[model samples]
Target: MKQPHKLWLRSLLIAAAVSVLTIVLNTLNVFEIFENKTYDLRMANSAKYKLPCDEICLVCVDQESIDWAKENYNWSWPWPREAYARIIDFISAGNPKSLAFDILYTEPSVYGTEDDTALGDAEARSKKVIQTFFISENDYDEPLFPVEQIKENAAILGNITSKKDSDDVIRRARLNYEYNGTVYPALGLAPICLTEESIDYDSIPVLEDGTVLLRFTKSIDDYLPYSAKDIFESYEAWKNGEEGPLSPEDFEDLYVFTAYYAPGLFDICSTPISQVYPGVGIHMTNLDNYLTGTYIKKIPGYVNIIWLVVLALFAALIVALSETCFTRYAAVAIPAGLSGGLVLSIAVPVILFNFGYWILLIAPLSAFIISSLVNIIFSLGAEGKQKRFIRSAFSQCLSKDVVNQIIDDSSSFTLGGKKFEMSAIFTDIQKFSAFSELLSAGELGCFLNFYLTKMSDIIIDEKGTIDKYEGDAIVALVGAPLKMYDHAKHACAAAVKMKKAELELNKDIVNYASNPKPSWMEDELYSAFKILVANNKTIFTRIGINSGEMIAGYFGSEKKKNYTMMGNNVNLASRLEGVNKQYHTNGILISQATRNLLDDDFVVRSLDKVRVVNINTPVQLYEVLDEKSCAKEELIAYASDWEKAMSFFTSRDYQSAKIALSELLKKNPSDGVAEYYIHLLDDYFLKGTYPQEKDNEGVAFNTEDGVFKLLQK
Candidate 1:
């Protein structure tokens, strides 16, 4: 199959896997418990609500109040009903907004009819006083109101049953419950109804199940509290004209909740804010929420489903995009994907919360996390495949550094072309056909393999890309698949090294043929081959280098592919290698384009300017003499005189140019560059008109283009 189709299929599979996992997790409702915990965390992190600290109060029958009452009034457990009657009368004088009793009075007082009469009379004088009742589900199914004597005098009766979650935490409350065809409001609902008598029942916000998510205004510690005995004691003190420890005026205009808070009392319940909270405090907060309309309305089930789908798709999209585009940068993208997904997971819910929408935090967070992991796994697998392919393709020819670059970013090594600036190196065995004629096919193969392996190693050591080998020639590229700023220098360096390696290989061949035969050589006829090598029947190669923008990528038929480079720039490098024969020069030849990018460390001499076959303009070429193979003093002197001769030749000074070349040829008798220049001078001198050396306008010595325009191949 085509590579593009395969990539798309992989991406689709990754998206599908993530989507399925998210759907399965959501279906199982596994994230609900985690979501609840996150809700608690957000609530804990949130700023406390600005509840009216003085608006509502809890008058507790705490142990402190019990002890105070016991010491002063000889009251112990089951105190007389007159004790509650005196406390009620004290608070009633202040005309509080609303008062609710969380304590139950299931039966008449055990003291007597007089004690019952006293408590009932105290209730009659109070305004907006509510008594707690139970909604019994027994066979009778009735509202279990307070005793008949106290019920007739009470202003209102409310159900006090608090609904608990499966976790045993009271997070929500029912607005009302029905018994015997009559709807009884909760202990909190009575105060709201009493305060907003003009509001319609249908106008209030309530769930379809007649419930609401309770909005906790404050912690249990923030609730205002007064002792039961303090109220009665303070009222007595004020009536006697002395300063009171507490007074009825303290309860004026506040919605008060009265309940038992002794440690042994069976009224503490777990809430989101506290593990052990007094039920009276819960009622107090509920009533305050109602009065201020702070009740939270939960989103409907349909909205939750849609939200889950949207979040899942969002997570899947991120995974797919990250996998397809950023596969090369897995090291960077993996962590970024994880962190970005996690941030959005948290931020989305928190943002919605500010707008009064409480989204499921953990479920969406799980979707993001699970999706990211799936994509990262797929990406890692794809990256591993790419690295393996790169190792297979380039490991034999390139250095570890170059190979590592491909491993680090496999996307750069895709099966397609990319245009980038690079340097090309081409090398060919001089007179290869003649050499092949002298050896058997197997001998030729062994020799070629040895020669090619040595030259390829030199190129790779300098970080060049080996494009291919054509019979007796090798083509290589630099600055491709991975960028290298000094590609020209590396190409030039490799060419010089290859020339040196060729000499070493020649020595090794001669040494091998002269000494005892190595164990690897199974042929007894190999001794006969040694005679040809010792006679200086050696191999020579010429190298060419050029630098420019070229196209490098995979090339071949459907069943095969080879990573190679191709362009006009590459052709010029090949031409330069062939141009060496015209001047009898060997070693390395480089175009002016390559020479211009080199540092001063290289020893190079200008050869000539010639237009090769199929190219329009003349190109300046240079011979890169191996300094490591030559005497330093001789190389320096030769380069200096050669530059002077070329300058004189281009300036139309034939005599001076001939003098310089003749002197240079005397010092280095085998200098091809000097021989070629002197031959040019000889040809011009014999033509008698000094060759005119002009353009079509007959201008003298027009060497502005600095090219010789070779007439011979």
Candidate 2:
């Protein structure tokens, strides 16, 4: 398969696996505790924006009320039933719709039968009152019911058993409880069932666990509270036909829930809004939810699974597309895209919660997170493999800097040519065939390896790319794969460094004779080495450098391509390497184009204007001797004299040129350039075959090309 198709298929498989795993875990309720925590967080934040139901109020028998009753009425811990009777009478006078107690009254008051009778008589008088009962699973065969007096006289009875999840958080409310083939409405649900005569209990939304998700719209503090002691005091005053602190308008048409609120009562538990919450608050919150029609409805399990699968696939798509992008920015963009996907996963559920729906958070979040992370790992592994391939393929011919550049932005280094200005260097050993003939093939190979290693090290150090090796020649280019504006200077610098390395290697060869030969050395090879040292003959390299516009990129057939340069400029550099033999000068030669870009750090001398084979343009050549700071004083003086001689020759002053050239040769006896010029002058005077026509530059030459043609003698 193609790479992109394989990548996409792999992404799909990863996403599918993650989704399936998350769904299975969710089905098993593995993330129940964590999912509940996230649900609570959303509830707490969304509750702040909703207004609490004003029709419901809490009549709390808190510590403050108990203290007041003790201080004023001398009431003890279990305040007399007569006190509750008075409060009931007071609230009943206001004509409330219904009143319920979150507290259970399964047993008679400890004060006395008459004491309980008093509360029973008052409850019987108020038909709107609803009494509380308890239904425990541990006692399912035998449940606890309110006393006969309270149960018989009250309007209705409800189960007051508060249910808690495994995490000890009360987020859902049980709507009903069954005991002995009879169903009892929960305390919070009883009032709604009693007030709404035509209510259908089955129509109410419930989870598969047979509970309703409570949307707590208010905190405990948000409910209006009436202290029990205050209500009792106001009841006494009103019985005398005197004005009371409490009025009937306060309870008119309201549903009042009364329960214990003191911390010492041990009726507190953890809820979404508070870690320490009153048990009464849960009933009140459930009542408020039912009354306002804002109870949370859970999204179906199948629907959530669908959402999980969709989210996983979406994340996979993003990763697959990003992996296919062959740009440097993909490195950064992939992470950002994954982060956005994760944020969307959480945001979607929270947004749905605001509209009264509870969407499971952990499953979808897990799918998105796991899928994104796995795909990222896969992409990184693939990229690492590509980088390894690039390093292995190019490390031999390209410098470390250039190889790293290609790795960083491989998009820029593709198949095809790019036209740009670059410098090309061509190097060949002087008389390598004759040198090879003197030694065996194995010996020649060893010598070539050592010499080439030294020269290639210098080129790589200057950030040049070795194009190829032909016998003893090395062709290389600069300012390709990675562009360097100072390519000409780098090329020239490598050439000078290579020449210096050559001198060092020659010294090593000469000194080899002083040391005893190794035991492994063959007799014929040892003899050839001694002969070379006795004659002071060493390996020499001729290099030519030229800088101009050329096409640089991968070239050749698809099966075997190379990163190299082409065009006339590259050819000219090769021809210049051969020109060093005809001029009888130093081994390094550069075209005028390369010389023009070189800085003052290098010292160069002009050779001639010559037309090389196969190139129509006559190019000026310069011999690169050494760096200005390292050039020998005698060689510098010889260059100065040679410059003077070239000036006279170009100006058609043949006699003066001949005299100057001879004097230069006399001072520097090894100066082959000066001797060659002197020989040319002698030929011109004897044969009388020199050109008489003057070109625009005032130089007279015999060739129609208007340039010198010096061939190998």
Candidate 3:
């Protein structure tokens, strides 16, 4: 392949990996779970406005209808069968589509039932008059009504059961049902209204699962029963024989909810609707809409996938741009993009919903998140790659010793999967996120490659393993490929040496943002931020050292492999580095196990039984206070201090531990990570809730071994 093609292939590979990873992560629900959440203001908006759509047609027995039925029928008893006759008579008079009743005649009405004789007599008479719609719940395609009534009217009874999620919020309505292996349209479903338009029932979509295959056509208002609650209740008054309350025309053309006023005969309960939705009534409305040809929801599937992918790719770009730039700009851009995506995604569907079209919103969001991840990841890789090249080039030029050291640790250079059992050190240039205040990518990369070459060289000299350099942090591991009985000692020594070197380098050339004559300065800064990728202010590392059995091999294919560790110990080491922040310490924080293995003359202080989220029990975090002594002494002292603090902290004597840590710290003023921990505990243990998830830099503890681990860069 041509160079351009190879570059394109590389970009494509990155994109494909991002796509696959997004899907995998989404499957893992990582983004959804860790994603920052925003409040749903749409619910408030929904509550404020009733869905005023002209789609679903209405014929409701509103609150007034309930009142009328109450005033006349002895406070709304189940209507005498004759009242239904009147409703049938009124509806039959008009050539409306389909008359649907949201009521169930599951049992015969009780009239004069003191004795079976009188009850039998009334039942015979009532059944005789309205037998047409005594529609039994059985397999039948045609309406089952009293013979004479059938001659006068044609209808379908509502057969919808509104269901909610586990949260009791009704968001879906069942629009089809099966009986005797044959599909039957639920009386309330819109297709039943097709009877009025004289459309064939087969024209509508039906899923094999006996459900309505949402094939909505036309606007939401085109179907009726769209009355406000106040308007639906008037029909009860018109049902009684004494006097017809509404004009016949009102009753004639209307598709009223022929449901009872009693709460037991439900049409008033709520489901998981957007707002205060009357579940049964809203269902009736939905069915009426289905009947009148005003469908809102569409068939969900692959057509939406294309848009989903596009949007996701777009999201990746937005996020990548954000990460590639300064945090402040990223702050504004990412959240705005995320929020805009969320709102536009949901709002478009809602607007379409109002317009009588239904579109799936959730899946699209899934796509956007996938896209954002892609862009951010790919962009970061681009930044890091440029930095890495600069690193490879400059270290070879800077000092032959550094270059030699890097070559010695060449097995651990790959990014995605490389492993080492050495101590992993994380250092940030402190506010390196500010470098782009006005610098281009090439300029920035040159700036970072400079210091990265030097600091990283010192680490390499100590036999450290280099992991990928993050935008501003160089994560390297020590004690791998070639282990030393005193690996922790070597790592600790190197950390101090590296820090001292960074300080020395910082003096010669101050302002790294300038050009070529100023090239060295730019390279230094670039090596740290863009190329070297330092983490934060003043070049200092948060070192987490856990040691145990770790893989010193390449992971991935021969085509593209990285020397990364993949074992329980490696993760624990990463967690420990992050834990440095909790402890408020700098350089060389080890696990309890690492301390246990070393000799006893040097002094190492106990940090705490720091809690990492993955671990239920806290691991003892220790600081290597004095690297000059035998590794044994520092480990022993650190182990002993933790032994004392753990006993105190476990008993919940947070105060005692706090003071003890303070004392330990006073004896060792160079420690920042540990002091931070003492204060963290003072602020936390005194409170009632558990502390937040561990940002122990990436530390994980092996209780069985009592060690600290730093597995990668």
Candidate 4:
């Protein structure tokens, strides 16, 4: 198959693998516990916008009620069933829609059978009252029902039994419970079942385990609790025809759920809103959800798996397609895909929660993350292998910057050319041929390698690309594969540093005789070294730098290509390296074009304008003396005085120029440029070569075929 098709197939395979893994984990309930926690967090965050259910309220049997009972009626912990009867009668007076007891009365009242009958009688009179029943297990063949006395007198019996998740949080309620073939509605659902005839029971969303996810709209604290003792007291006040703190109108048309709120009752459990939530609040939340049609509907496992597969495939395709493109695109697409997928993974489920649906977040999120990571790892492995190959193949032939550029974008390796304003450096060792002939081939090779390595290191350090080496000359270019705006500055800096390094290398050579010679040293090599030492001469390098528009790219045959620069400016740089011999100036020189691009970081003295061979345009030249930071005071003073002398000579003021040159030579007798100019003035007087009339144009010389030609105007 084609590469694109193969990549697409690979991405599909990765998506499939991730989806299947997540599905298996989902089936095994691996993410169930954590998924439940995320669901709770969504519920809690969503609760901030949900208003509390005003239609449903709690009548709590709190400690105050218990203490009041003890003080008023001398009742202990278990109040008489008659007390509950009185409370029921008081609530029924207001004609509430329904009243459900969260408290379970599965056993007969401890006071007597008549006490149970009294409570049951009050429930019968109320006619809207609902009692609770409990079952330890759901799959029991036979389950014990509530006591006969209470069961027969109550209006309806709801299963108050609820289950907690693994995290011990009650987030779902079993709306219906089956016992020995009889299906009973939950206590929270019993009131809704009796009152709301319009609700389709089958339409209610439920999990496979037959439980409805309860969307808690409010906390237990949101409910204003009505004390049982206070209700009893209100009942007495109504009987005496006097005003009371609470009236029958308070409970009118409201669903009153009564349960224990006292901490000692141990009826609190962990809920999404609070760790210690009243158990009775769960039933109230269930009723609130059902009444408002806001109960959370869990999305089916199949639907979740579909979403997971889609998201995983999306992530996989993003990585695969990006990898198929240039590596630069892959670098951006991978992170964007990972972050975008993660955000979507989280947002989908939370958004669904607002619409009363609970889509599984972990399965889809895990699929996206795992699939993206796997594809990214594979892509990196492939790219890494390709990069290693490229680096190995070209690291020695090209600069590190060029090799890296090719690695990042392989198109750079192709044979192409583009013109850019850049700098080129041509370096040659002075008198290298003479010294090389005196040593063996091995000794010559060692010396050249050492010198080339030191200079090459400085070039690379300054971000210059080594073009090639011709015998003992180094040709390099700056700002090609990687464009730098300060190419001229960097090229000049490399030249300066190379000069400094050469001085250090010469010192090493001068001190070589002091150290013990190697056992393998040849007598001829030692003799040549002694000759150099006797003459007090060290190897010097000449560097020429020029900056202009040059065509830089890979050139040569298709089979064997080389990256180099070619233009008139490149020729000029080579010509300037040889120009150092004309005036016997220092080792470094630059063209006027190059000098224009340089900052004040370097100190250079102006040389005469010269027309190089094969180039008709006369270009002015400057000799680089030393970096300003390291240039000696005498050298700075000499350069300044030399500039004044050149200015006088350029204006045809021969007398002033001769006097200035003489004075400069006296100060620094060994200054070759000053002595050369002094001799030039004497030669000009003898030959009458001086210009007859003053001209704005300076004295121009020609280096025709590597020989200097004196100019006469």
TM-score of every prediction relative to native: 0.50, 0.53, 0.38, 0.51
Evaluated against the true structure, the overall lDDT of model 2 is 0.77
> Which ranges in model 2 have alpha carbons more than 4 Å from their true place?
139-141, 382-713
Order of models, best lDDT first: 2, 4, 1, 3
Can you give the lDDT of residue 172 in candidate 1? 72
Taking every candidate in turn, the Cα RMSD to the unseen true structure, in Å, is 42.5, 42.8, 23.9, 39.7
In candidate 4, which residue ranges exceed 4 Å CA deviation?
1-5, 138-145, 166-168, 196-199, 382-713
Poorest lDDT segment (10 consecutive residues) of candidate 2: 691-700
Model 4: per-residue Cα lDDT over 1-713, one tens digit each: 22777777888998999899989988998767557657777888788777767889889888778889999999987788888888789899999988888876756777888999898889889988888877765365445566787688777778877678875678899887877677788888888766776346676776788788888865776765798878988999988888788998899999998888763363656787775587788788878877777788878768888899999998888777676764465555555656677678888888888777889876787788678656655554577775764465346545799778866775454344689889999998886756665666766666677679999999999999999887679999998877888998889889989988988988877776556666776554555556567666687898999999998876532223467777778878987887776677768889898899888877888977766654667778898877788888888888898899889977667789999999988887878878877776786643556422122122343223322332211
For residues 461-517, write the lDDT of model 2, one tens digit per residue. 999999988778999999997888999999999999998898898887767656777
Candidate 2 TM-score versus the reference: 0.53
What 10-residue stretch in candidate 3 is worst by lDDT?
Answer: 33-42
Measured by lDDT, the strongest candidate is 2
Superpose all Cα atoms of candidate 1 onto the true structure and report the RMSD in Å to 1 decimal: 42.5
Q: What is the lDDT of residue 468 in candidate 2?
A: 83
**Alpha carbon lDDT of residue 122, candidate 3?**
35
* Best model per TM-score: 2
